[model samples]
Target: MDKNKEKRPSFVKRFLRQTPHAITMLFGIIVLVSVLTYILPAGSYDRVLLNGRNVVVPNSYKIITSTPIDFLGLFKAIPLGFKSAADIIFVVFAGAIMFAFMEKSKAVENSVGTLLKKMGFGRKHLLIVIFTFIYGFLGVAVGYENNIAMVPIAAVLSLALGGDLILAAGISVGAMTIGFGLSPINPYTVGTGHKIAELAMFSGYGLRSVLCFIALSSMAYYNVRYFKKITKNPEKSLGKGLDEEGISLSKPIQEYSVTANNWLVLSIFLMGLAVIIYGVFNLNWYLIELSAVFLIIALLCGIVSRMGATLMSETVLKAVSLAAPGAFMVGFATTIKVLMEMGNIGDTISYNLALLLQDMSLYTSAISMAVSQSVINFFIPSGSGQALATLPVMLPLGETLGLTRQTTILAFQIGDGISNLVNPTLGGLIAMLAMCRVPLDRWLRFIFPMVLVLLLMSCVALIVAVATGYN
Candidate 1:
């Protein structure tokens, strides 16, 4: 053997061996998306504002000879996305700060102990079920991005229950995604689609409720199965990939107890969440209102915890610093949308997808619509955004194909929703994963199979919606 021979690592070998950082992977996606812009011609429909949202006009698409993104625009997408997502970023930051104070109070942990004791569930499976339903209900009745603040609390609960971080994400992110995807009365997706389909808002609740139950049950069961697997073999724990150190369950110093201070903190936090839900549903509260609620929750928690104003300020600032990475990850994910917008290919994609359904059978068209909605979601990730952009084209297409309006909307919402679970372009899920220190690759590995399952369920539900003429 030659002593001078060096085992130099090949570039391909090293690249395949190393996990790309989240931002690196996201940028690669952005690059691929940007390249597609030049390949697809720029096209769009005129839009009219109804109730403050710009809904696309059907049959209004026209090709535009727009310039493809220059090299400068590639880097500029980051700042553009930040501008577009400013409100979202602020609320997420506020939520993080609020949760930081709540973490300091240790109220969430103590409250969980009290909750477990009160619920009389000695087994952990029930807790998993409850979490899936609780967060799933929030996703059903409320919104997705707003619930991100609760990720840490969920993580702690999962840890305490002897589960890994992935279980926490599955119960929270996976369940919420499913709930919102299939929910009958979900204000954002179903509500928006109904408006576009010209059906009374939330009129077809019966079928959606049944579909939602099936999806939620599947999510809960998956979380329980995952929890059992990890707990059975700690070696299989996905939490091993987490970057943050010192993440483990707290051992009760003495038999668990909640003090007066703990109770006050818990009340304040719960009340704040209640206010958010009510505000979102009734008062149409959004980013600013949500941020204000977080501030109130934090100040009250700090006061009850007897932390001085200065201490609270420092704690929150420290928290903001810790969460800064997650926030930036959000901006990176948002950049994907920003790039698509920069090139004006979103409508082109939608138009082409709509064309695919023209020659298909009714049921085939329905399933094809669901698949198209999933594709559309990659460009415009928001539930309501997809409704505004795609539903106009889809509803007309469905009408032509002898499909009911509800069937069309069902396919739109489900496809748009199930895709969000693994869609790296969704800022909220990406940010939440960053907060939990879960790697994107591992999350996809853990959740992609479930996404496929949910997508299958979604397709079947669409078929049912068509067969029953649900409307």
Candidate 2:
């Protein structure tokens, strides 16, 4: 090779580098779903508010005249999605602001470095396992969106602990998604699905707990493996070039003291989280309330750090500028659902899929229901929303096929939970990816294998549930 001549990049490398941006991918999805409106029949189910949540009325579905999205209407759905998802977008922006303040204060860096030092470099990877379980528990306890504010902190910790952005997101969002998917107590999916099935609350706790363990363990393993690969060879990292320019593990770890100011900042962050958890479990707070909690915490941190108003304002503006793309991606991802609703096909797709499960064998029907739920999740990313929309029809179909309600709920849990790992419509996933500066295409490529394994494991669990006649 000529010393001064640059080597040509390989074709595979060129193609990988050329992968479409997350926003572009989401836009393409919007177009595809809009087209689906024309090909798939338009239909809907009557909906009523139950316990302050909108739920589809059981046995109320009917085919309606098609209202396919036209070209102009397709473009209109983007803004419509933005309007509907505004709360979440605001949450993302607020989180970025908080993270920026934390970074500026050295609060995140000092705290993470100190924690890793205590763990020792040899045992550092253990942090992944620990945080994975912690986030997983939170996922089961609270909903996924409620944890969006935590991603930036996780990213900081990941980089500090000799890992990359993907690993950071994996331990946080990835673990939460796993927990959300398999949680027996996740009120959003499990609670709502059981209600729609008229089954006792958290009725299948034993099987679900076992599945949760299996899924989390699998995720922890994946995280460790990827961390090791990137640690050994930085070029293997999806964040290779990006990591060098921003946060780098090669940077020396500073000894963070437990100063009074550090304590105040840390205490404020922890107290805010505790209150948020309390509100979620007790007060039933959602996106807007969660965003407020973090916003308050950010302000408190800035005050404790003693940054003047000018500096604080500048910091927030800069953080928001960096996070702007992520905020937009969240809104764009929501357009998939917007388009589906505009075409009146969200329920139609579910209705038709449920109709197909009428004659399947118990095992097959159980697995098929899970698969259908996964597909439905792409359109209705909200756990409670999917439960309300699909479980009504799935429960009746499960009954007709002699499948236990518990088995049906199991299908719903797996279907709704696992797909979040890859669903573009999931705002939290997009926001987390954006925070870490990882493109959605790269994330899909990295996570697709793990998703397949998780899905297979879920199928096996469903089979066992059917065999044991789980109730």
Candidate 3:
């Protein structure tokens, strides 16, 4: 036992020594993207205001003067990223502290544990399905950033279910991203693409829904398989360092019991979720409103749990402090997007990608559209941001290449969605990983196979979409 404990720590030590911190990785990517702005020719497209949002004018591309990020600008891009992504950054910190305080009353554990029991432990795979699929479509209705608060709860549940942080992230934020990436409602990608393509809103959801289901299934299977592997053998866990505690969150079976207080806290949480959902759909709430809801939930949990002022203050501080690293990384990851915009290379890259799809067979052109979009997704990770930058150019370009506007949008979703699984530039993804305490490298390694599977599915979907004359 002594030897085994010593060996585990050494392995953890080695892992930490070797693993690149997410912030460091993102910082390097920021530098790399900044450099590309210097190397790539700068370009811009004329934009026209439509319904208060600027719509990219198709075929209005022109090469502009190159104004790449200089040395000072490189550092400036980070704070710019922080300002731009402040809403999401706030969500990350808010979600963490809220969950931390809720868990302090042991309320979250008892409540979720009770549900797991009702789920019959035998049906834990169903839990993965519900978390991935249901959560995914919820992402469709409300963007994934709104669902950020659920990740820590899912991570705790995943740990209780004999899975690691990667699995937690996979089912929660990971599945939700599928919805955001492929949302037929055009909450971001589809919606913006439709407006740009001049297609009727909700025009091609049949094919998009099919894509969403298949994509969700692929992710669900991957998450379930991972859960089974880790449960049967704890060594299969991919998290390193202190995160290796896959099953430690669970108490001994006999010791587990939910109290009335647990029920109260759970009710508060559920009601909070319901309110968030209502506000999002009805009031059109975003980051600030969502963060306020979570903060309110945390304070209510503190009140119901009857902690003193001093204890409450300390708890809130601790949760926020614990959340600091992930929050910082969230802003850090957005730096790449900031640097790209600052360097004025976003439209230039889009113009060049449109040029690549100029002459190809219809089916091949559709897939190529997706391929090119996937490449651009690396720099501009936001679905709407990417759509605004590239689709105006690609939409008209698609017309010349005999691809439908709907088909082009389909390719955009495929390319954007799959790459989001691994895009280092996305603040939402970085925030999820940070919340789960899953290192960036570990997640990339864990999700690579699934991403490859999803990519294959995306390619096949794009080809089929074109062949059927989908519009």
Candidate 4:
């Protein structure tokens, strides 16, 4: 026997060495939820059509026939989840392809480089503020999930601007998290929550806007401080390994010259954004419509860049391949909800939780509602889905405790939105981190402080909503 021969690692050791892939984790959650159905009783709330949306009727819960998912049914739910989440999956694909095409044209690189150069080195903090606002606005307008496609580009820009990957995540994902948490008009959370509570759409915009400002301002300050620290001593960065991963721009900053064509392409992009805003605010467009808008913009960008048909097709294909795994993860995440519903235990969980909260004071109940929603968000990350599942039980419970429906919605918004930043089960955050090659553990450490600040602010905001009779 050769004494120097290397011994192979055991299978368990090798498996433990590997980070749990996002899809594998989500599938495990689905299986766990399906098993819970057998142990938990089955119940449901009566639903009614309100403003063309299905909303649960208050106090309508009743124990129903059990429908525990069998092994075969659990297997079937994989495809069913993909089908239900198709719209968002395509949105991810379209957004990735659009940005990929822009990268191919060197449009984004040129714009970012030129903007940084113009801002000069001394004013770099201003750039952080600007990007943070833009990302936050996107979150408020659409959603954080829809903005996952932008993470890589933001990473490159941050690196080029003398910042690090964490700074990039802070400005892009962090700002978006703040916006998603406090957005006055985000249809996914605010709109859905309001509809479920039978309140007028966006009726509490004044207070929400104030909260958004405070959250974003604080987040921007945190990002700036971190950026300054990392720029001074790169070795201290939490995401130090991410820099070695080479997620930066392919060419040097000097190579990316801002040409007239670049401005034209950018102008067209802004116009498309305007069109999307109108479509969302007036036309009431959603994931499908937003995807179409992005697809059209991608084509226009290709035309503006004067790329040949084959070149455009190849670029899109490359992007689609790059984004395929993330899109699949989105579908996989949706499976948790599908399994819970199939097991017929979603309402049962809600029913028990409501009963637990029934005896608490209004303040305690509101706080509990927010905290419980945060926990539930781990399993059902989709804002609209969570609202549909929990609001019926929460709304009635709030009313019984002399709480306003608006306060209930506020609790839902805070709980559902803030948890996205930290929840490992959230596909969008996982996808963004994957794009930047940032590990989940490292991100958790870097972001935990901000999470606490945001949660504290959220509690204060909920209290204000209750005291002011926010309805």
Top candidate when judged by lDDT against the true structure: 2
Q: TM-score of model 2 relative to the true fold?
A: 0.93
Clash count per candidate = 0, 0, 1, 0
Residues 1-471 of candidate 1: C-alpha lDDT, one tens digit per residue: 754456666564344346566777888988888788788899889999988999999999999987588788898988998888777777768877888888788787777766666665467899899888998997887777667767777777777777888888888878777777777888788888877777898988887888889889988998998888887898977677664332343655245578889989988988998998899778978878988999999999998899988888888888888777777777778998989888999999999999989999988999988888888898899888888988888888899999988888888877888888878888778777755657676787678667778778777877888888877
Model 2 alpha-carbon miss at residue 292, Å: 1.8
Question: Which regions of candidate 4 are displaced past 4 Å?
Answer: 1-24, 141-153, 192-201, 204-206, 232-247, 250-256, 423-446, 467-471
The digit string of per-residue lDDT tens for model 2 on 1-471 reads: 785456776565565676687767877888889889889999889989887877788789888999999999998988998999999899888887877777777766777777777777788678888888888887877777777777777787788787877887788888888887788788878888777777788887998999999999999999999999998998888765553223433346554545677778878888998998899878978888988987898898999899999999998888888888778888989888888888999898898888888888888999999999999999889888888888877887887898888888889889988999999998888877777767788887677778989999999999999999898
Predicted candidate 4 versus true structure: per-residue lDDT over 1-471, tens digit per residue = 765456776554454445464455667777888889899889888988866667777778899889989999988998987898888778778887777777777777787777766767678888889888888888887766556556767887788787887788888888888888779997888888776777899998888898888889888899999998887888868776553333456666566678898888777777887787787678877778878988998999999899999999998887787667667766777777688778888777767877888889878888888998988787677788788878877887788899998889888888988888888667667666655556665666677778889889888988888888888
What TM-score would each prediction reach against the true structure? 0.91, 0.93, 0.91, 0.84
Q: Each candidate: what lDDT?
A: 0.81, 0.83, 0.81, 0.78
Error of 4 at 112 (Å): 0.9
Give the winner by TM-score. Answer: 2
lDDT of 3 by residue, 339-420 (tens): 8877888888888888877877888888888989999998888788788878878887887888888888889888988788
CA RMSD (A), model 3: 5.0
Q: List the residue pairs that clash in candidate 2.
A: none
Judged by whole-model lDDT over C-alpha atoms, candidate 3 comes out at 0.81
